[model samples]
Target: MSQQVQAVIAPGENEPVRVETIIVPDPGPGEAVVRIQACGVCHTDLHYKQGGISDAYPFLLGHEAAGVVESVGDGVTDVAPGDFVILNWRAVCGQCRACLRGRPWYCFDTHNARQRMTLASTGQELTPALGIGAFAEKTLVAAGQCTKVDPEVSPAVAGLLGCGVMAGIGAAINTGQVGRGDSVAVIGCGGVGDAAIVGSRLAGASKIVAVDIDDRKLETAKSMGATHTVNSKETDPVEAIRSLTGGFGADVVIDAVGRPQTYRQAFYARDLAGTVVLVGVPTPDMKLELPLLDVFGRGGSLKSAWYGDCLPSRDFPMLVDLHQQGRLDLGAFVTETIGLGDIEQAFGRMHGGDVLRSVVVF
Candidate 1:
């Protein structure tokens, strides 16, 4: 039987998301129905509402979520009913070229529930954001999309592993390969940037410099483990980072803002043979122009992180364990807890730089 649940939906471009009744169908083969316990409000959800992602209208906009499996369809054995899981967008297909090459994180094909949830009133099909529409009481997703984790953790904190937090931590640990005693600089101190700082610290980075235009964000970054903070509005970030790192540059520089200018800052603010990891999502029209000589002179890796190049099966459980052991402060990322109806308002607060994460808790 189809279940009727109140969900958050972006009806059109730049439209305010409304709480509407949507029909979630019974899970089919390889799928499961999840009773959402908590979902984090992320910038990506705002991008979806603003038509930045795609023209797919009436989008079901929440993705970073943790929930309990209420039911499973035929052939779904990875997860069973009553299991606590963190929803991940990337459900790797083991047969893909990337997976065959032993890098499933770059899986060419990811899976989502084949079924669609419809608007109960109009019967219009709702596009699940990132293949895991989660701002509802319950959602349907591929069984692989649900990674079972320790149920003792708070849902609000666990759900963040689904996206932004995972992206940031992965950018530093997996992509940048931050190591002990290395100097690291992270540009843009939002949730992602801050998480990178935390990851770098966990990796034993000796000098962690955070650069951001907002002093407020920089202050937050300091609490997250940054040893130094640079206000880009007052100084050149590349120069400041270089100055902080003995007139050289950081061993690893992460560009979390995903802007061309920030990309250049990261490119130039790295030591010789240092790594520059671009974890930020850039738009199509955005372009980068750097001197060919400078590119050669940098002599290091230039990489982009997709979902932090994280393998959900491996990373989520370990991170949760770290959080449980009090070694990683995942709960620090949760700035506020909100109801489902307040998601639209949370977006505005996010844009205004008021909170790190405003999670929707059911």
Candidate 2:
């Protein structure tokens, strides 16, 4: 049977999201219905509202989420009812070439619920953001998208592992391969960059430098384990990063801001054979230029950290356990909790730079 539930929706391009009644269908084979508990407000959601991601209007806009599985369809042996889980956008298909090669994290064919949620009023199918939209009271998703985790952890904190948090930490450990005694400089003090700091600290980095225009964010980065803070607005970030690392630059430099200028800084800010990780999202129109000789001479890897090169099944549960053991503080990423209706204001707070994350708690 289908069910009617209240959900937030972007009705059109650049349209302000408003509450609407959506019809969620019963799970089909290989699908599950989740009663969402907490969903984080992320910049990607904002980009969806502005039509930056696609022309697919009326997007169901929430991806970073956690919930309880209310039910699962036939053939879904992995997850059963009453299980606590964090929703992930990547639902890997094992038969893909990448998966067959034992690199499922790079699975080319990720998926979502086969059924579509529709507007109760007009029955128009709504596009689920990242295929795991959880801004609603409940959402249907493919069974593979739900990764069971420790129920003891707060749903609010667990939800963060779904996206930005995972991306940042993955960028550091998985993509950049940060290790003990390594030096890391994260360019950007937002939630993602801050997570990179935490990851570096966990990996036993000897020094962690945070570069950002805002002092407040830099301070937050410091509290999260940054050993040095550089106000890029005042100083030449590339030079400062080198100075902080004893003039050799860091072993790994991550650009969480993803802009041409920041990328250039990252390119030049690393040691002669140091790695540069780009985790920040950039617009399509943006272009980058660097001397061909420099690219060839850098001698190290330049990587774009896609969802932090994370494998959801492996990383999510491990991170949850880490948090439970107090080795990871996932709660710090959540600045405040608000009701679903407050998402609009939460978006405002996000842009105002007053909050790291404003989570919608159901």
Candidate 3:
């Protein structure tokens, strides 16, 4: 059996996402059907619409979602009907080399639901965004992709742990390995950047610096645990970060805005031997032209954080527990909650930097 539901779809490049009727199939083997309760509007969704991700037209959008499992297919044992879960895109295949080596987070063969949701008419098939489209009443995903979490928290809050929040927090704690009393700087004050600030604070960083072109986001960063803010428009950010860190740059500099310029700034904003983490999503055409000598002279690791180096099974529960304890302040990320129809407007707000995260609540 299949279910008919309304979902946001990117019909073509630069076209506004439309809410249309989408047909979601029953869970196939190793799959489960989830009745989505909430999903966050991440920048990745906008990328999908801009043809930045792919030309997979009529793409079923929304990935960072949380909901209750409605049904499970044959051989599905991880989650049963009635279980609440946060949908994860990376469902590790234990046989993959990364997983076999005990690093499931880097599993190269992460799986998704084998069946594709599609348009009812013309028998046109649609590509599910990030393999877990949830901007609808329901979404189908690989059973392993649904990580069961405590259901006590509102779905709106729980859903964020699926993406941006995880990226930001994990970039600092996991990838950057920020330690207590360390000085951390996050370039770009968007959702991912602000989450990095919060993560630094949670990791006990003594000084958290936020750099951005927008003053509003800088203010938002402060509220999220930044000890200082730098409006890059009016000052040299790398120098300011250096001065703020007492003649040495931050111990960890994160480029949350993935661009060559910001990447350059992040490279120059960290102290010698300090780590520089790139958590930003960059364009395919964007190229780095740094001197090979400088790259070698940096004396530190230039790393790109894939999904914040998050391990769904390990990080999700621990972060949820932190949120439950009221110490992590995950609520700060929710600027507004809107219905599925407000997604287009939310994307505008996201580009305008007016909201941290506009979540769609089903």
Instruction: Give the top-scoring candidate (lDDT).
Output: 1
* Ranking of all predicted structures according to lDDT, beginning with the best and ending with the worst: 1, 2, 3
User: Which tens-of-lDDT digit does each residue in 17-96 have in candidate 1?
Assistant: 99999999999999999999999999999999999999999999899999999999999888999999999999999999
Q: Which ten residues in a row have the lowest lDDT in candidate 3?
A: 119-128
lDDT by residue for model 2 (1-362), tens: 98999999988998789999999999999999999999999989999988989988789999999999999999999999999999999999999999999999989999899999999999999999999779999999999999999898999999999999999999999999999999999999999999999999999999999999999999999999999999998999999999988898899999999999999999999998899999999999999999999999977999999899999989999999899889999999989999988888888899989999999999
Q: Across residues 1-362, which tens digit of lDDT does each residue of candidate 3 receive?
A: 99988889999999999988888999999999999999999999999999999997988899999999999999988899999999999998999899899888788999999999888765689988899998989988999999988999889988999999999999999999999999999999999999999899999999999999999999899988899999999999999999999988999999999999999999998998899999999888999888898888879888888888989989998999988999888888999999989999999999998999999998
Report, for all candidates in order, the number of backbone clashes: 0, 0, 0
Candidate 3 residue pairs that clash: none
RMSD of each: 0.6, 0.7, 0.9
What TM-score do all the candidates reach, one by one? 0.99, 0.99, 0.98
Better lDDT candidate (2, 3): 2
- Per-residue lDDT, model 3, residue 342, is 94
Instruction: Say which prediction, candidate 1 or candidate 2, comes out ahead on lDDT.
Output: 1
